[model samples]
Target: MARENGLQKSLFALLAEAHPEAIVTLQYQYRMNKDIMTISNTLIYDNKLKCASKSVAQRQLDLPHFQQALDSIHGGASCTKQSCWIEQILDPSRKVVFLDTDKMSATEERIMETVVNKAEASIVLQLAEALLLAGVPEERLAVISVYRSQLRLISQSLRGRPGVEIATIDKYQGRDKECVLVSLVRSNETGKTGELLRDWRRINVAFTRAKSKIIIIGSSTTLSTTALFGIFLELMRTNNWIYQLHLGAENEHTIQPPPSPREKRNREHKTHSPAEAILKNRPILRDVYNSSSL
Candidate 1:
């Protein structure tokens, strides 16, 4: 399996070489949560969404363009996790779910499993971003976890935002989304790395949950990119992967989004500051929440 994956990695590298602008096929970060939510109690029209003092995600909520993006999401994008999102686009009532670790409340078994197995937790913020753009009300959306405490922090990131709720991956396991957006965060040989396979199976589980499509936000390095000391660097010097994804529609729903830039360490800007949140283990939705301390 590892060797097969290695070949896939080589192909990806070739594709990356010929097409340097390619983004990772594996996509969206995974998240954690605990609970069995039927319907969200929140609303998107709340005042918190309008404040520039919040997540770019929140700021995005109020934009007419953002709403347009959701309305424009007509599908055909290649994602296993995306199947549900596409359906949600076609049918707003379609169920949507996010997967992540959920058992870290006190036992920390899942978290430890992830950590000891070389796991770097991933959060589904981008899938949430796409859903947010697709007009899925936060309340209609659900976040599920394998470990509750592990996901609590991720849940807090989307908290008070409106239209979304949290749940456990177990609850949504048997269910399907119109499309599924599985986010893979950190995958190393640790608990997280071992969980990488489990996560992959879970992702397969998540993908099958979607009746139509599945989109993955994972390590582009897995196939095309390479990770040296945990930093993502491209390896393929030949094939260039973008053309494969861009085989047809030269203009339509085609143009691949740019891969994260080299300076990606600072990509989130002030609003989507994962580092700040990681440092504090709390959501810091501002330009510089650390300014006061600085």
Candidate 2:
């Protein structure tokens, strides 16, 4: 299948099902509270919801290139998720959903066969920064996935973000959103979203919560190989459909490619790694091999 407008507009919206199927022997809660929804294709679902600022006010800012790009709803050519500006989500309409899409891959199964060590734990910084930037009301937003235990610390990171709630996908089973931002954290060849389940139904539950927009941010390679991306790509390949394809783009939200060996040593010595950073800062070390010798 091709990779284009992978998720159609209609495919992004949702309604209550009359005959909901019951497969797992589990019980959960569904909010009948004054359910809130955001315009511009926001959704509420059992698992995730996301939002991007498409406000008229946001559009008119005489900002730099980065800000202008962010203001564009589909700025695929240069869309980014900056740690600083994510606070804009607090404007009462959109909420954020951080996803982890690496379920039963070889990577998941073979982690420290002898040591029951923790998953890389520092990304909590990303989650914390997301909370601040999105400006989402904690009471109105949440965190969900199978990695609840690993992400529990993320809640601590949000103490100032209005005490956001957290849950597993099974728990998200009936709620909906106004604007949804479903993040898929997939570093795997298989795009399972880090859960044993990645069927269209699961994808459906995650996608069909919006009345206006649904934006998925995940491992870009997954789109080329996974069924979820394949389905949408297939649909787009045949039509004039186009959705912004952003992964590790330039401006913001770009993953600083993991440190190479030399870069790692420089960081350990508290020295600048780049020529510009080093020249301007002027660290007194000449040889990274021996910091004291230098």
Candidate 3:
């Protein structure tokens, strides 16, 4: 099982490379707006296997209604005529948002044998409830995270609610919905990411799961320290897809770390049994074991 856990060795990976023509890319995306598509494109642009509809013309694009809705919501004359009408209509403050929290608050906890970010979970719950109030169909919305604990926490909050799926990134793969809200739960003084950072495939799966819109709630400051996330946040900034609750606080700052070996030290230690302790206490038995070992 351990040997077969590799992505490259997976059946899907083999099939993808073996028969490229057999794979079909869905060009016409009714799920996400052009802006969301653009952001997603930037994230996976460097991928070896490219999307067939790289050009807008080939993709059969449709006009996003958020701009029209915004005009109606606040009258046409209020907003300046800009190229990014979708953002103007939806408002970055609501559509694509970042909720920052302290390192202490963002700490992970083991619940039901799963690691969950309680701070992030709480924020997602608030957002989900708000979205529900905004008349978003419960069936059309999903809450995704990289940790099972977070999923467990979110699932509990939305319990008995129909059509709302809460899952981890791996579980969300190959699934699409109208809206997805991702909770990137890692936060600390050091810009340390867990196993999730190294798994770009899972990250890609999580980001691309949404059809209409995605609201990402996370610690931008901590995330920007990593290469992949730094690029993701940069694209958000460049595209004006960022919605901030706090003003004049620069959250996305890049500190370029010199390239070196990226090594991760395991923080978890294995537990020893009482029988193991008793064996160690007996020096004569331990010595005989050592002598036979040679």
Maximum-lDDT candidate: 3
lDDT of 1 by residue, 1-294 (tens): 865666534565677889977754432212211000111101111122121222321211122344455434435544433433333333332222222222211112345434211121222444454555655555545544445554565454554444454554555765644344444444332323333334333433443343322333333333122222122112111212111111121122321222243334455464665665566654454435667657
TM-score of each: 0.33, 0.38, 0.61
Q: For model 3, give the RMSD to the true fold.
A: 19.7
- Model 3 lDDT, residue 130, Cα: 42
Ten-residue region with minimum lDDT total, candidate 2: 31-40
Give one digit per residue, the lDDT tens place, for model 3 in 180-225.
8888877666777777765777887887777656777677777888
lDDT of 3: 0.60
Pick by TM-score: which candidate is best? Answer: 3
Q: What are the lDDT scores of the predictions, listed in order? A: 0.36, 0.37, 0.60
**Weakest 10 consecutive residues of candidate 3 by summed lDDT:** 248-257
C-alpha displacement of 288 in model 2, angstroms? 59
Q: List residue ranges in candidate 3 displaced over 4 A.
A: 1-8, 16-28, 46-94, 102-105, 110-113, 245-294
The runs of at least 3 residues in candidate 1 whose Cα sits more than 4 Å from the true structure, single-residue gaps closed, are: 1-123, 143-150, 161-165, 189-192, 199-201, 211-213, 220-294
Candidate 1 vs candidate 2, lDDT winner: 2
Better of 1 and 2 by TM-score: 2
Show where candidate 2 strays beyond 4 Å.
1-135, 189-195, 210-214, 233-294
Q: Mind sharing the TM-score for model 1?
A: 0.33
TM-score of 2: 0.38
lDDT per residue as tens, model 2, 102-155: 231212223342211022222333433343333433354454433455345444
